[model samples]
Target chain A: MKKNPQTAACLLIGDELLSGRTRDANANTLAKALYAKGIELIEVRIVPDEHKTIGNALIDLKVKADIVITSGGIGPTHDDITADAVSAALGRKTVEHDGAMKILKAHYAAKDEEVTDARRRMARMPKDAELIANSVSGAPGFRVENVYVLAGVPAIFDAMLEEVLAAVPDGEPETVYHVTGEAKESDLADGLRDLETALKGLKIGSYPGPTGKGGPLTIVCRSRSASVCEQAALAVKALFTAQGKEAEIGQGDRPA
Target chain B: MKKNPQTAACLLIGDELLSGRTRDANANTLAKALYAKGIELIEVRIVPDEHKTIGNALIDLKVKADIVITSGGIGPTHDDITADAVSAALGRKTVEHDGAMKILKAHYAAKDEEVTDARRRMARMPKDAELIANSVSGAPGFRVENVYVLAGVPAIFDAMLEEVLAAVPDGEPETVYHVTGEAKESDLADGLRDLETALKGLKIGSYPGPTGKGGPLTIVCRSRSASVCEQAALAVKALFTAQGKEAEIGQGDRPA
Candidate 1:
């Protein structure tokens, strides 16, 4: 098993999600991205737009995880109190940031629309916080004491993550291999065990996804070590092919 | 602050989610449900179909959260190891439960298929575990100790959760109200302060969502008490409308 790396916790805020009205895709993406970056995503908490609940969750994660990233409550809507709650958690007054306000003013003005005080609320930040860049939207996210606040919209979240991830220290990048053709997963179970034993540090997992044609298994091999992951994957491929199972090696790409 | 409730955490397992193939809708739904049930969802961890990662996350959540629910990684596929990892966490050997086997046999027989050994794996559970009824799928979920293992598919997960929730104790139920047509959030700032001050146990949140015509502002009020929540919402409505702002009631039920 890989020793715990730098860990992170995520807090998702919204009511639409709780009512099963909207599905969330961010947690899964963030988890995969963090895993490849060698950051252990230890926990995720989803609370509604309740100030006390959000405040408590923030305080708790700050004590537990090395970093915390929050999404959803940063919007210009009335329910967006993630920033306020984060401020409460840090015992800092939520104040309008000049830079953020400037950006929002420019954005609203560029679109030739009035920047209502409600819209201006998007520019608020915790005391002495750095701004997280939002490439998808002009409304920037903020960071305070290791907590990165981001917008809930998927496009903005994905774009902001590129910058957020750049700031996070990398541990080990994960690798992957695709194996397919005429093999039941159990057929390779013994070989997988052998590989797991041979490469103790590397973690190998198989996924049987529906190939475009049909159900052909995609054996995914992952590890913190690039070399170890590749070696194990190749060994598995060689063994499976020799045993008359059609298996193929996939190109390695670190999860974003 | 409601003084921390019983801690709860979730473990989401599946390569479908990791690969961005299946957009996860369950995490938020469960988080909200758990929160309403009075379990403070402390953390949610997503792991692929790797034993070590799943096992580690399971152990971690078990120790951290008072109750833990895991979804996905319970299937006939070789990639599924939630049962094994769960067993490992409980320090119990995985054994095929006779009742589960019987259920699985009946399910497969209904579909006119032979129960393969791989299919039999779905019947495996840790010693002395109770089953979470799955009306959506024949493959059932399990609950043991503080952990409630559930299916990955959204429909099945929802069905199982209905039963699981009934068996579990209900937390304090929260009341929600909608206050709409507020001219500005700042207009209600003073009123919000007074209401929050008066309703000590209640939480007053203001959210201005996009009304259908993109003209009116909505103020949402939430509290554990129905009367308090209604009173707060009424106070905000009267205060805002007095200032020539359109103020009507809204809900935490729908996005403000």
Candidate 2:
């Protein structure tokens, strides 16, 4: 596992998403998974299913991040051209991988169905790409260089991500601490800025929930050093206390 | 109102979104609103709260699309550097808008709360930027050139978008038709390809829903011309019928 914090980008390809017909869940799922493994998801792009668009985005994102994970456009349809786009981006020929073919064949054979040409299309991959196991569905995702092309379906995408994450080396996970208070963000903004400046490399964020919520202002402090994160969390709590407000630490399940 | 289809992009800036701590609803809400106004949301980018990242992304997205809408990072916090980034991107100085200051002062005064400096920070906007009305919240979003900077909160973002959309010119709205069936996408892949080729300027997409759903396969046809979209939709339904599968038209409310 790599100790350094690695950067990741998510490329979501689907016309439905841009059309406002579908809200994407894959990016959020992938982001959380990558964060747990100490990888920072720096960028997320949602592009249409056009070949040129997907191919261009893949090329651009690969240059910007250490790893790029793409979801969608890997189905058995004409618009499902993610494989071809990836091949184009990598300057590799799209070919039927023997391992991917066997997986699809076995899955279909067990169901008493023939492997049709359209179904076989799912087996095609960029040359030199390695297959990523898809336990939930028959069609497997593939990795070419730092780009991992996964399924669009949320269930299958999540399942395949588990395997992908297991294979990838872990990076330096960030230690995070959450503090919630009744004070408005504006009331503590200056103090938060001072704390952030005093503690270098400490990232703090303030999220204000709706009024009447037990603690409307939730502050998140994250750093590679757990001690630094803990220290910053205390400082945040002190700011709320100075405002005559009660601050609770570690009450929220997620970061702000 | 512009008669031709206008391309738009959304730039969402926040660490919480990338951390999976906050699932973005602003982009989806903006996308849907823009679609109704005949604008095509071609790209959506979620970047971190870093100044350079946000500034660079804003410059890039503005070049590609006719309009760019950014949500998040416009709050009173250390991480809320979106205004500064936007100012840098456009090479404009940040200044307090008199109108925005009045709105913030009135809102806070009505609540019998003192207007703090951190709260006043929300009044800052890029030079030459016009304020967008925020009926839900006092802090107004600002428009600079083709870029519109909006709040991150879902309710506030949605409300501001309504005003922004109303001010922008309407484009040529695409007419969409949906057809869903039980047939597998692969079974109709070849037919879809043929239909796509036959209908120029028509965009078609295939989305497969989860199993056990009555109509798992949905076909979406979209075009500026209603007649053309309707014609392509019928072709899709005919393909499903040829496969001896029942194709239901308009069973779903949204496009596939």
Candidate 3:
């Protein structure tokens, strides 16, 4: 068994998210993107824009995972304190990065505008940071060691992630085999438990979902090995079949 | 200045959420619900179904806020390790509560079915737990001291929250005044910074949002005092008006 699978944690920093004023679109977006690259997002922590709180949470998340990514607080506003907070967490000083400022200036220059001090805020990051290029917007995110500080805006965050993902070494992506059937989650619980114990390194999840679309329940088998995933799926299908329920293998578990 | 607004931290547990197989609907739902009840949701932590991870995360969150609520992992399945993890977190032994067992049996009895061992798993909780009633589903959630363990399903979680909210003492609910205008977030950033400093204990947020629906950007003022919120809102409106933009004051920031 491989000891490492590339674990990551996300620190979602924003007062808007904590205040219930904004539904955070970034965590889910990052989760999907990271999963596609085979990085197991082990933990996600959402903290307000308070300086000490952000710093403390970042430190906590940093200790938990290999790559720690943060969304929000990279913008050009008072609440945008993610860079400074992350810097403080690492016991480093935040300074305006020349590369980031050049990007910001050019982005604003294209709009025939000067980069104001407010706009300049986007350039400030940890002193030893490497810029994460933003394709959607001009303002760039930064990387300090394994930590990636990203924009809170969905478009820019998504755009910046492509650059970040390019730098990360992808692990063995889990092979998922999803089977849906008439068998309820509880009906297959015992049999699924036995299968889970029997199959080493195979992760199984049973979801109680929509009724009319396909079936009432879904049993998803995921593993690093394709053969294990297939075996688990077949066993799950047999569990449903034993109970006189019809089961179907699908492309993926995302219900259409 | 009031120091304490009843604070809450949520621990969302599920492998499906981490794997990006499911989008978590509970955090936003709980955040809005808690906010409406005057509870400041200070932090949210999402951890997968691994036993130590859940327990450790739960213990960590329990220290950060006045109330800790957990969503997911209370089902009748192998992956439903939340109750056991939480029980272990508190250094308490897990036992099948008679009351919970009674509820589970009654629920199954209503469906003219016997409660299987798998169904019996729902009754297992920490020794010193109080039942949190579930109106939507028959299985009851448990509260261990300040920590409330609830269902992961949106509808069931929402229903269980009603009872949880009823028990929590309300804080001075933050009053929100939303102003939308053509002025960009950076256009008002410097002036908004002054307003934030001038107004003691007022929290302000600037969101870059949709155009054509109403306007380009939104300025939200939130404070425990309604008067402070109003003053901040008016100040924000004046800033937009100063920028030659139409500013509209509205009930809340949920865009129409």
Candidate 4:
């Protein structure tokens, strides 16, 4: 929003999702979180748990985006190869993280379950990686270079990211103003076009629906500067009022 | 489900999506549609209208993925440059498709709007492209080589894809069977492990969820073959019932 803002990309990994067995909810959640933090979400890619595919996508995103976050493929089963794939992509070796293992062992011991060799696989991390504390589950996430490797499961991933996002520097996220009134897009097209041309950096979009004196048109005006957003919203209101349209301008947030 | 199935990739082009100003409903819809048609959705990428980024992603996807479907950046607006970027990626010249131009001109004439020079931009297509008729909107889509380009808006894109998908040959898509019962993944861990080891081609994963039968797990059996899927589902059903757990079988559909 200020100058040369940092950008992030997301890589969703898993065969179950590709097969349509699982409807992923994390991508949208992470997108919303990053947007609120002012980090530009440049791209989102969903790939199967294949080494070559994941490795290639990671390398590609690394060259373009400032930060990359990956979710899924970190389980005890054979298909969970996120750690291994991350290591291969970064040209590093996979090693056991003692701290992660300690946490996992404690979790299993509390539940009175034997920590078998298969379960220990969850403790493995890429070389020179920092562990992200998982509050929902004992299996910790890891960060190598600018790539943050996280689990696939929703609950655990959300908890881990809550802590991870706290460490990221905040950028200046754009504020939004909304005005929903009964007006056809065609009726407001000229004014919207003129407003868009004048706004420059500010974005003015009209979503149209319904038909009547007050046609349903949801106008969103967004900008990095709060004053700019307010000014644009006021100008839009004035134009709509002049056209004998009813419109209310307010901050774009949940009504509740 | 067949061996070495044809791969498909999606290129979502729009600045609103990258800036977190819009939620992408097209990717999931396209993925589900492609799956039903037996086209393996290999990768999905969200790229801005920037020429270099779109060109690079298009080149990479075209080489790796057999079919590439792109949405957005084909409208009349100045920001719409998907056609130009795609042609650049393929090292081809941008040219106007006569048939598309005629249809667009007719549509504008019917609406009584002047077909300005800016509106004519929508008629431009890359050389050697085939038009994919749009049912909802008059702005036709284009297909060049293995790349299928559609509008970024959901309604128009969906209608255009439905028409285009009918022309493409259907490959074998993966199928699935769901077996849920009063069971525990840990309890079935060793047995499921043996089954996974025995079935080389079939994929069996256990999803732990709230069991209505006072149990702790819901195992999902998936395979490329319906027979294999049925066999896996039966085995799980028999094993769970024998273990004094209530189990039921269900079916699922997945893209190849």
Residue B108, candidate 3: C-alpha displacement in angstroms:
1.2
Better of 3 and 4 by TM-score: 3
What's every prediction's RMSD, in angstroms? 6.3, 2.4, 3.0, 4.7
Residue A253 lDDT, candidate 4, scale 0-100: 31
Task: Write candidate 2's Cα lDDT for A1-256 as tens digits.
Answer: 1224399999999988887888888888988888888899999999998899999999899998988899998877889999999999889999999999999999889889889999999999999889999887688999888888999888888878898888888888889889987888999999999999999889998888732122478899999888889899999999999999998888233433
Question: TM-score, each model?
Answer: 0.70, 0.95, 0.95, 0.83
Better of 1 and 3 by lDDT: 3
Q: Per-residue lDDT of B22-71 in model 4, one digit per residue for the tens?
A: 67777788877877767788888888768998999899888878888898
Clashing pairs in 2: none
Candidate scoring better on TM-score of 1 and 3: 3
Ranking by TM-score: 2, 3, 4, 1
- Please tell me what DockQ candidate 4 reaches: 0.28
Full-model lDDT, candidate 3: 0.84
Per-residue lDDT tens digits of candidate 2, residues B164-245? 8777778887888889878988889999988988988888888887431224788888888888888988899999999999
Q: Please write out the lDDT profile of model 3 over residues A132-226, one tens digit for every residue.
A: 89877778888887788888887778788888888777877888888887776778899999999999998888888622122478888889888
DockQ of 1: 0.18
Q: Which ranges in model 2 have alpha carbons more than 4 Å from their true place?
A: A1-5, A210-215, A251-256, B1-5, B210-215, B251-256
- Per-prediction backbone clash count: 13, 0, 0, 4
Residue pairs of candidate 4 with colliding backbone atoms: A72-A152, A182-A214, A182-A215, A183-A215
Q: Number of the top candidate by lDDT?
A: 2
Model 3 segments beyond 4 Å from truth? Answer: A1-5, A210-215, A254-256, B1-5, B210-215, B254-256
